[model samples]
Target: MDIKKGYIFPKPFWSSLIDVNIRGLQEECYEIRNNVPSKYKSNLGQNSYHSPNLLNLQNPPEILKLMKQITNCIQTIHQQSRRENVRLVDFWININGKGGSNVPHTHPGAKYSGVFYIKVPKEMKRGNLFFLRDYNETYLTSQENMGFFKQGYNLLPYDLPKIPVKPLEKLLIVFPSWSPHSVELNDTDEERISLSFNYILFR
Candidate 1:
């Protein structure tokens, strides 16, 4: 007898390290964090600073370069024509210090979201990013665990509950805006600095 299986319902994210000045980006974030008031909070918790929208930057050349790369990525992900541009609706900085973490949340109103890491703690798992499976009774009654075949360590995306994306300097990641996700605590002494933005296809 012969047997076969089918795959379905896969969630996806795109990530890469673009050719940009990492040091310059880091300095830019620090400058914003120093001058901007982040007294109000959103998803960020303890020792974290969330900057106001960065679209207002007068002439941040490095940041503009990064934005160009991000737009290119969005277009690539969607297989869109390079000439067709998407609007960068919002842009901001995130600085997470020791004990900083983000609550589980999803971006609304935007079609896609992304992040760019500038400064990350040398210690792995410090402020780790995680992608969570949508809340549901998925595979509740399936006799076999989806994450692994009852034998070898081959992993499947469907069977897994969540995915942890470790932060690394110069790393950039993009995913559906509706994807639920969060961050782990930054136990290390250093701060983890990253930029985040939302985008939508041009109408």
Candidate 2:
């Protein structure tokens, strides 16, 4: 008998190395955090500063340019018809200090969501981002507990409960808005700064 592999339903996440001024972006973000009053937050945790919707405020030039780059890339990737278009509906800043962590959550109402790492400390732990699988899917086929844990067996994504992602400067990650994700506590002394946004498809 012969057996092969078939990739069933796959959830994809796109990441790109964005070209922007990280230092300048950091200064701008800090200034905004100092002066601007936060109206909303991204992650619910302590020792973190979350900004409100930047779409409603005077965003820095670097942020605006970065947004243009992101939207342009999305347009190219999605390749929607002339009748359809995509727009950034909301955006914010996240600066996670030591001991900062967020509860698991998902973006609702919008279509796509993403985050850009502006700053990340060296030799960090508990600062990683984790994309998790749905809880209801924890049936008998659950990857968390499989008796077949033997030698010579390759571990695929289907056999993992969560995927870990290390944050790097200038890295941008885009994914479906409904994907549930969370951040671990920032155990390092340095801070972790990132910009998050959501996009919606419109006609």
Best by TM-score: 2
lDDT for each residue of candidate 2 in 99-159, tens digit (9 for 90 to 100): 8777778899987888899989886866878898877754555745555666888887778
On a 0 to 1 TM-score scale, where does candidate 1 land against the true structure?
Answer: 0.86
lDDT of 1 by residue, 1-203 (tens): 79998877677899998888988888887877878887454555578898888786663778889898888788788765345557788888889888788887788998789888988888745577889876663355233543435677676665566788988888998989999888888888888888889988774
Best by lDDT: 2
In candidate 1, what residue range of length 10 has the lowest lDDT sum? 137-146
Query: Relative to the unseen true structure, what is the C-alpha lDDT of residue 200 in candidate 2, on a scale of 0 to 100?
Result: 91
Q: What is the C-alpha lDDT of each candidate?
A: 0.80, 0.83
- C-alpha positional error of residue 15 in candidate 2 after TM-score superposition, expressed in Å: 0.6
Per-candidate clashes come to 2, 0
Collision pairs in model 2? none
**Residue 37, candidate 2: alpha-carbon lDDT:** 73
**TM, every model:** 0.86, 0.91
